[model samples]
Target: MSDTAAAEAPSPSVRSLLIMAVPAILVGVGSALVLWLLDLMSEGLQHILWTTLPQSFGATEATPWWIFTVLTVTGAAVGLVIWSVPGHAGPDSATTELVEAPLRPGVLPGLLLATVIGLAGGVSLGPENPIIAVNSALAVALLARFVKAIPLPLAMMLASSATIGALFGTPIAAALLFTGAVAAAKGGGALWDKLFLPVAAAGAGAVTMHLLGGKALSFQVTPIDQTDGWMLLWGLLVAAASALIGILLAWALPYVHRGFHALRNPLLISLAGGVVLGLLGMWGGPMTLFKGLDETTELLRHPGDYSAGQLALFAGVKVLALLVAAAAGFRGGRIFPAVFIGVALGVLAHVLFPGIPLSLAIACGCLGIVLAATRDGWIAIFLGAALVGDPVVLPMLCIIVLPVWLMVTKAPELVVHAQPESAAAKA
Candidate 1:
C-alpha cells in the first residue's frame, strides 16, 4: 500500500478505504438526485398553495387574517406528526449537529414526512439539510436491509457528501460546507476525505436541475459598476444596521427555539405559532412569507419595476417573516433569508440615503446577514459581493463584513447555543 493511503484512510488500509468509497460515491450521486427532486416538488407545491390562500374574503392591503388561519391549520397537521414522532422535529439537524447521527434506516420516512410538512405546511425552512436527515435515514435503512456488511461511517459520509453537493447548489460549496461541518463535529481522520465524490454529486444535481428546466437558486445578474467614493461611509452604515439586526435575531433564537419546546398541545401550539407568524407576515410582503431566497432573486431581477411602496412593504415583511418562521413549527435555512432581508434593508437605505450607491448598499446588506449567520468574515465577503454581481460593491462587502462579524462575535454568549458533535465519530 502507498504510504499516503496507509496514513490517511478512514480504516486501516488503502484497499479498505477504496472499498468503502464506492458506496460513498453512490451516496453522493443519489443524495444529489433526491435533494433536487424534493425541492422541485416542494417548491411547486408551495407555488400552487399561494394561489389558494384565503386572501379573497377580506382583501386588505397586505396578507389577510385568513392567511394566518390557513397557515395555522397547515402547521397543526405538521405539528401532529412531530409531536408523535421521536428523533424528528425541533432540534439542530445533521449538518448543524456537526456529526453523523446514530444510523437507523427506519428513520428516513419520519424525516422526509416532517420535512414535507415543514415546507408544504408554511414553515420557512430550507430543504438541503432536512434532505440530509431524510437521505441519511433512507441510506441507513437500505444498507441494513441489503448490505449488512457496509460500515456505518461509509454510509454516512456518502450521504453527507451528496447532500452537501446538491443542496449548496455547487460541488465546491458543498465540499466546504461538509468539511466545515465535519471539522466542527471534531471527527478525527475526516481530513482524509477527497473532493472527487462531492464534485461528481454536484454535477449530477446540476444535471437534474437542467433536465427539469427548474428555476435555479442563483440568478447571476449582469453587474452594474457605478461605484463612487461615498461607498466607504455606506459600508459602515449598513454594517452597523446589520449588527443591530443580527444581535436582535440572535437574541430571539433561544426564545424561538425554546417556545416550540414548551408547547403542550403540539397541533394547537403550532396553530398559535402560526397565528403569530401570520400576523407578522402582515408586515413583511408575500416575498418575505416563504424562505424568500427565490423571491429575493425575483425582486432583484426586476427592482426597477417595483414602486417605493413595493420595496418598503418587502423590507418590513421579510423581517417579520423570518421572526414568524422561526417562532412557528417551520424548519429550513436562515442565512439566505437573512441575505434577502439584508438586501431589502439595503434597498431601504437606498431610498433613505440617496448619496450611497445602490450596489454598495446591496453588497453590505447581503454580506451583513452572511456575517451574522456564519460569523465568518471571509465567507461573508465573498457571498456578499458575489450576490450583488457588482465589482464596485466588492470593496465595501469586505470592509463591512468585518465590522458586522466582529459585532456578532462580541456577544459570544448568545452565539453558541447547543453545539452538536461531528458525524465521523458516531458513524
Candidate 2:
C-alpha cells in the first residue's frame, strides 16, 4: 500500500481485539500459576519453620527467643544468597521501581529464591513486587519465543495485570490500579480499549485463583450501621492521621536505608537487619512478623483481644519492621505491611473511641496508610473498601481520600530514589 493509504489505516481495528484475546488469557493463566506456586512454596517452608520444626524442638508455641533466632538465621540465609548468587538475587528491593524493564532470564531464579525465603522467614513484606517481576520476566521471555507479534510493553502489562489479579483474587483491583497509568499515557483510543487486554488477562488470572482455591485478600468486618455526613468527617480525620503516620515512615525510610548501605556489605547489613527485626518481633509478638495477610485476619477475628497499648505497639513495631525490612534489602512490597499497620491503626481508633463502627474504622485506617504508601488516591480507596469487603465503605473512602492526598502529595515516596549511576547499575 502507498504511504498515505497505510498512514490512513486505523491502528488495529476496534473489532480486531480478538487477535490478542487468546494471548492475554494465556499470559494471565500463566501468571496465576506462578503466583500460586510461590504461595505454596513459601507457605510450605513457613509451615516447617513455625510448626514442624518447633514441634520437633518440643515447643508448644514459638517463643520470642525462637522467633528472634529464626529471623536472624533467615536473614543470614538471604544475605548469603545475595552475596553468592548470580543476579545479586535480583535488584535491591528498596531501590527498584514497582514496574520496570523485564528482568533477564538468568536473574529470575535467584529472585524467586530470595522472595520465597523472605516470605517463609517472616520478612515484613508481601509477594506483590517479586511475583509481578517474575511474571513479567517470564511472560516477555515466553512470548518472544512463541508470539513475536506481541510487543514487550504489552507483555509486561498483561503479566502485571495477571499477577495483580491473582494476588487480590479479583480483576477489579488490577484494573483500578492501572487505570491512572493507562489514562495518562499518550494514545489515540478510548480508555476501555486500551484496558481491554489487561482486563482480559486480569479476569483470567482471577478465575485461575478461584480454580486453585487461592486465598482472597478480604476481611469479614461487621457491616456499617449507617453512613452519614458525620461519618465522612470522621473518616477524613482517621485517614489523614494514618496517612501522616505513613508519611513519617516514608520520610525516614531512605535515611535508614542509607545507614544500612553504609555498612557496604550485603551479608552484614542483611544480618544486622535480621537481628533488629528479630528483636522487633520479640517485642511486638508474632502478629507483627511476616507479610500481614494472615495477621490481618487474626486482628479482625479478635478485634477486642488486644488492649489499646498492645494495639499501638503492634502498629508502631510493624511500621518499624517494614521500614527495616525494606531498608535492609529484603525482597518484598509495602502493601501487606501497610495493610497490617492500617488494621492496627483502625483497631487503635476503636479503642480510643468506642462509638465508631469497627468496619468503618478499619476501612479508614487502611485508607490513610495505603494512600500514603502508594501515593495513589484511587488504590488507597480501593484497598480500604476491599479490605472490609463492603461497597458502602467506598463513598466514605472516596471522601476521605481528598484530605489524605493533600498530606501525602508533598511527602517523599516509600521508595528510595537512587542516583543515575546506581539506577543504571541496578538495571
Candidate 3:
C-alpha cells in the first residue's frame, strides 16, 4: 500500500466499471426474456379474443359486441385485481413517468397480471412501463443481495437500458434515449465511462431480442433519395399540427381521468371506462384496439387499403383510445399507442398532400406527436426514423423535429397526477 503503488492502482470508477460489465450483460438477457414472455402471454390472449372467439361465434375477429364485452370485462377484472389485490398492482401509471423508482419485489406479480390482461384484452397500451418496472425491481433486488457494490441507480439504469433495447430491437435507440441524462451527470470523466455498462446491457438485450425473433417497429417505407426544401416546409406544418393535436389531448387527459375517477369506485370507474373504450373500439374497428405495434404494421403494409377520411378517423379514435387506456385503470405505457396515432396522422397527411413523400410525412407526423406526448426529442426522432427503416429519413426527421419540439417545449405532458392514495386507488 505504498503511496506510489496506490496512485497507480485502479480507480474506483474503473473498479466499478469492471464489476458491472458482465453483470449488466446478464441483466440485459434476463430483461429480454421477461419481455419475450410478456409478448407471448399478451399475443396468445389476443389470438383467443380476436381469432378463437370470433371463430367460435361464426363471426369476424373482434365483432363490435365482442369488443365491447371483452373490454368491459377486462376493466372489471383489472379493477378487481387492483382494488383487492396486494400491492395495488404497483403504482398508477398516471402518477408515474416513463422512468421511475423500482417497485417493491412483492408488487411485481399483481402488476404483471394486470399488464398482461390489459395487453391481452385489446386495451390500447404497451408493455414498456410494466416490463421496465419489473426488470428494474428485480435487478435492484438481485444487486442488493449479491452485488452490493453496484449502486441501485446504476442497476436501475442498466435495467431500463436493457428493456428499452429489447423493446425497440436496438441498443442504439436505448443509448440515444439516455444520452442526455448520462451527459447531465456530475462527472468530469469521459461520457463513455458512464455509458459503458448501459450500452453493454442494451446490446445484450438487443441481441437477445433478435434471438427470440421479436419484431422491431418497421414499415415498408419508400426510401428518400432527394431532400426537397418544400418537403421540409411541409414537414414543419404537419409536425406542428400533430404537436398541437397532441397538446389538446394532453390537456384533456386530466379532465377525462378526473371524470372517470369521480366514480370513486375502482370497479365502477374501470367498468365505465371499459364500456367507453369498447364503444370506441367498435366505432374505430379492430385497428384502434391493443398497442399500435402490430396494427401499425398492418396499416402501413397497404396504404391504399384505407382512405384519407378513414385514416383521420382512425387517428382520432386512437388518440382517444390512448388517453382512455392511460387514464383508466389499465397498467401500460402510452408510447406505442401514441406512435400508432402519429402514423395514422402521417398517412392522412400524405393522402391529402400527394406531393409529399410518404416516408417524410410519416416521420414528421411521429416527430410531432411523440415530441408532444413524451417530451423527449431524442426518442421522438428515433421513433420516426425507426419506423421508416431509412437512414436518409434521419436528417430529415431531425430537421422536422426542431419546429415540432419548439411548439411542444412549453406544453404540459400527457400524464395525470392527483392526491396520493385516493387517486391511485380510484385510477
Candidate 4:
C-alpha cells in the first residue's frame, strides 16, 4: 500500500502497539540465535576460507593477505547484491539504530545483507547492526503476519524493546538505550515510564542468545588498586582527551565520507581507500586491517605486548584507518574502532604517567570518546564497562561523562548519523 493509504488506515495506537510488539520479542530471540550461529561458524569459516585463498593478497591474523583479498572481494560482491535488492538495504547497526528508528523494514534487510557481507565476505564490520535491524524487522513481520489486533504504539514499543533487548543482552541496557533516545528526541517527563516494555524485550533477546549458547558479553580488566585516587584524576584527563578525539572524528566524518566531493563513485572510492588501507596493513600487519575490536581483546589479554611508542603509532593509525573507512564507502561503525584508538592513547598516557592505571586510562578514553561522539552517557557507560571487563568503570564513567556530556550534548549529533546514508555510502 502507498504511504498515504497506510497513514489513512493507521492502526490504533493500542492495537498497533500489540501488533508491533509480539514480533519484537520473537525477533529479539531470533536475532540472538542468528548472531550466535554466525559467531559459532565464524572461526571455522575463517579457517576454511583462509586455507583456500592465495598468499600474495592482503593482511590478516596468522593467515596471509590472500585471505583478506577473498574476503574483500566477497564483501563488494555482497554490496552489489544489496544494492540491487528492494526495500531498505538493511540498517547500519549495533545498539544505536535500535533506538534510532523502530519500524524501518527496508533498513533491516539492507543491514543484514551488509553485515553478512562484512563478516562472511571479509570486509570489516559487525553483526550488531544487522542484528538490531533484522531482529526488529522480524518482530514487525510476526506481528503483521499473526497478531492482527494491536495498536501501532504497542507494536512500536515491542519492536523497539525487542531490538534493544537483543542487542544489549540486558533488558536494562536495552531499555535505557531505547528510552534515552525517546527522551532525547523529545525533551522531557517520565522517561522511566516508557522503559519497561523494552527492558522485557531485552530479556527475551538475552535469553535467546543464552539458549543459542553464545558467551555473554563481558570485558576483562586486571585488578586495579582502589587506593589509586590519582587514577580517577588521570581518568578525568584521559576522558577530556578522548572527548576531543571523538568530536574531531565525528566532525571529520561528513567531510571524510564525502572526500570533499573530490571522489564521486562510492565503490571506487571505497576500493581505493581499501587499497591504501591494504598497503598500510601490509606494513602494520594484521592488526592494521579490519575493525579493531579483536585488537582491543588482544590489548587486554596482553597489555605488555605493546610499548609506549607502539601504542602511540597504533592509536594514530587507527584514527587514520577509521577516517579512511568512513571515506571509503564501507558500511561499518566507529565505536569499537574507537575502542582500539582509546586504549592505544590510554596506554601511551599510562607510560607517561606511571601512577595512573593503564586500564583506568583506557576506560576514560574509550567511554569518554563514545559519549562525546554519540552524546549518550548510559550507552557509553555500558559499552566501556563491557569493553574493559570492569564494573568499577561504570560509576567512574558515569562521573566522567558529566563534564564531557556538557561539552558535547548541546547539538547531540551522532558523527555518522549526522550525515546522509548516501554520504556514508560514498564516504
Candidate 5:
C-alpha cells in the first residue's frame, strides 16, 4: 500500500465521524422515545378495554362474551379508522417488509392510530412493523429538512437500527442484521466503517430503551449444560418441523388476504376477521390474544402446567389468530406472534419427548419459524438465542438453522402483492 494511495482512500476522519455521531445518537434517542410512547398509550388503552370497562359492566374477569365483544368491536373501530382516516393507515401491512423506503409524513398518523388500536385490542400482532415504519418515516423527513448532510438512505438505516435495538433491548440484534446487508452492498472502506453510524444509533437506542425500563426479550429457561448426539438430532427435527409449519403459514397468507379483500369493503373485512379472531381467542384463552411477548413469559413461567395437547392447542390457535389479524387488515407485525407459536411448539416437543433438553428445543423452534417467516437468517438466529438466554445453544442453533434456512429459502414469503389498480382503489 503506497502512502499516496492510502491517503487518497475513502477513510472517515475523526471529525467527520464525530459530526455524524451526534445526529445518529439523537435519532436513536428519538426512535426509542417513539416506541416507548406507543407502548405507553397501548397499555393504557388496554387497561381500559380489558379491566375498567369490563369491571364497570360487572364482569369480574374477561369472559368469552367480553373477549368476543371487545375483539369484534376493536375490529370495527380499526376498520372505521382505516376507511375514514386520511392515508388509509399507510400501506397495507401485508405488502410491507420490516425495512422499506420511507413513507409520506401524512400517512403516519393514521398508521399509528391503527397500530395503537390493534395493540390494545388484543390483536395477535406485534408493534415492530408499524412502529418501524413510523420511526423511519419521521426520521427521514426530519433529517432531510434539518440535517441535509446525512443522506436519506443513511437516515433510514439509523432509524431502523435504533428501533430494532429498542425492541430487542440490545444493539447487537441491529448490528447482526445489518452486517450481511452492508457486506452485500457495493461500497468502499472497511465493513466496520460502513457499520459505524448504524451501530452508534443502535447502541444509543438500546441504552435509551433500557433507561426507560423496557422489558427484555429473553426469559428464564433451564440452561443447556451439555450437548450430545441425540440432542443435536432432536434439535434438527424440531427446527425442521417448525420451519415447515412457518412455510405453510407463509404460503397461505396471500390466499387468506385475498379472501378478506374479497369483501371489497375494509370495514366489513375487518369486522369479519374480528369475529373469527374472537372465536379463536375464546378457544385459545387470553394468553394467545395479544402480541406474544408477555404471554411467552407467562407460558414459560410454568411449562409444567400444560400438557402436550394443551400446548399444541395454544400454538395452533395463536397461529390462526395471527393469520386472521394480519389478513384482515389489522395493522401490526407478525414476528411477535410467530415467536409465541414457536415457543409453544417447542414446549410441546419437550412435553411429548422429555429426553430432549428444553433450551435447545425452544431455541431451535424459534430459530426455524422466525427464519421461515422473515427469511432473515441473522434475525432468526438472534431471536432464537435471545429467547433461551443461553450461549451453549448458539452452536447448535447455528447448525440447525442451516437446514431450516434451506427449507424456507425458496418458500413463499408471508406478504401480498396487490395489483397496482387494486392498491390505488384502496387508496
Candidate 6:
C-alpha cells in the first residue's frame, strides 16, 4: 500500500474497543472474585488447622509437633486428591508456567482442591499458578459459550492478565509483564491498540480486588531518601548474591523433582515431601510457613527482633521449604515464596552491614531473586519497587538488575520441563 493510502486507513475505532471492554471488565471482576473466594476458603481452613485444632489440644498456638503433623497430613491429602481425583490436580505444577493454554473445565476442581489444601495446610507455595489456571479455564469456557466474538487466545490472555492484576493488587504489574509478549506478537496494530483490552481487564481486576479488601502487595519500609555510590555498590552486591541463590535453587529443582518422582507413587512422593516440609517448618518456625505475604509483613514489622543469624536461618529454611513444596508435586506458584526469601536475605544483608540502607537492600535482594526465579526483568524490578513502596529505589534496581540478569540469563529456570513420552512412560 502507498504511504498516503496507509495513512488514510482507519485505525481500530474507539467504539469497537469499548464494545470489547464489556467482556474484559467482566472477566477482570470475575477473576478478582475467584481469587478473593480462594483466599477466604484458604484462610478459614488455615484457622481451623493452625488455630482451632491447636486450641482444642490445649495449646495457645501450633507447636513444632503440630506443624509437622498438619503438613504431613496435608501432603497425604493432596497426594490422594492428585492420585485419585480427576485430572490429577491439573498436571504437575512444576511442569507449568504462570500462564499456559486453558485447561479442560473438568480439571479445575481437583486443581482447586489441591491448591486450597496446600495453601491452608501451610505449604510455602502461593495461589498464583493454580488460581490463574482456574480463572483461565473458566474464563475461556464462559467466553466461548456466551461471547463468541472474542478468540480463545484473547480470552486466555484477558483472564491471565486479570488474575495477575488481582494477585499483585495493581494493573500496572500486569501491563509491565504483558508488554513484551504483546509487542513481539505477529499483529498489525499499534502497541497500545494491542494492550488496550488486556490493560482494561487488569484495571477492572485491580479495582475489584481493592474494593474487596485485598491488601496491597507493598509494605512499609524505611525509605531511602538519599542515594550514593556506596548504595549502588551495596545494591549490586546484594542483588547479585540473591540472584545466585535463586539460580542455585533453580538448578537443583529438576534433580529434586526427579528424586521425588522416583517414588513413582504420587502419594508416597507427596507424603515424603510433606514429612520433609514439616521438619523444615519446625526449623523455620511459623514465619516461614504459608505463602509468605502475611509472614513477610510480620518479618518486616520488627526486623530488630531477629538477630543476623536468625534472619539467615529463616531465609535458608524458607528456600528449602519452597524447593520441597514445588518438587513434591504441591499445586501452587513459586513467586510469593521466592519474594519471602528475597526479603529475608535483604534483611540479613542489612543486619550484617548496618551501613547499607534497609529499603535499598530489601529492594535489590527482591529484584535479583525474582529476576532469577521468573527470568522476567520487568516483574523482578516491579516487585522490588513494590516491596519497598518507594520510587527512589527504582533507578538503583534498574541498574543492579543488569548484572544480575547476565548472571542468571543462561541458568536453568525454576520450572521442570515435561519429559518425552517414551522417557516418561519408562519412568
TM-score quality measure for candidate 4:
0.78
> Best candidate, lDDT-wise?
6
Q: Return the clash pairs for model 5, or none.
A: none
The CA lDDT of each predicted structure is 0.60, 0.86, 0.86, 0.59, 0.89, 0.90
Question: Candidate 3: deviation at residue 232, Å?
Answer: 0.6
lDDT of 5: 0.89
Error of 4 at 181 (Å): 3.7
Per-residue lDDT tens digits for candidate 1, residues 1-427, read: 5656645546335665566556655666676677767777766666555654444554432455545655666677666665666544534431253234644545555566666656764555556556766677666667667767675665565566566555545555555555554454433354535444445555555454455454444445445556555667777787678657766776776676566545545555566667776666654545656666677787667766666677777766665566556555454556666777777776667767767666666777777666766666655666566566676666666666665666788653222255352231122
Tens-place lDDT per residue, model 6, 72-118, is: 99999998888878777887888889998899999999999999999
Q: Please give, for residues 364-397, the per-residue lDDT of candidate 2 as tens digits.
A: 9998998888877777877888888777888777
Model 2, total clashes: 0
Candidate 4 lDDT over residue span 6-111, tens digit each:
4355323555445445655665666567666656565455555554444334433545465445545654544454445553354333214323445466555555
Quality of model 4 by C-alpha lDDT: 0.59
- The residue-level lDDT of candidate 2 at 284 comes to 92
Q: RMSD in angstroms, candidate 4?
A: 6.3
TM-score of each candidate?
0.77, 0.95, 0.95, 0.78, 0.96, 0.96
TM-score of 6: 0.96
Quote the lDDT for 95 in model 4.
Answer: 18
Q: Which 10 residues in a row give candidate 3 its minimum summed lDDT?
A: 3-12
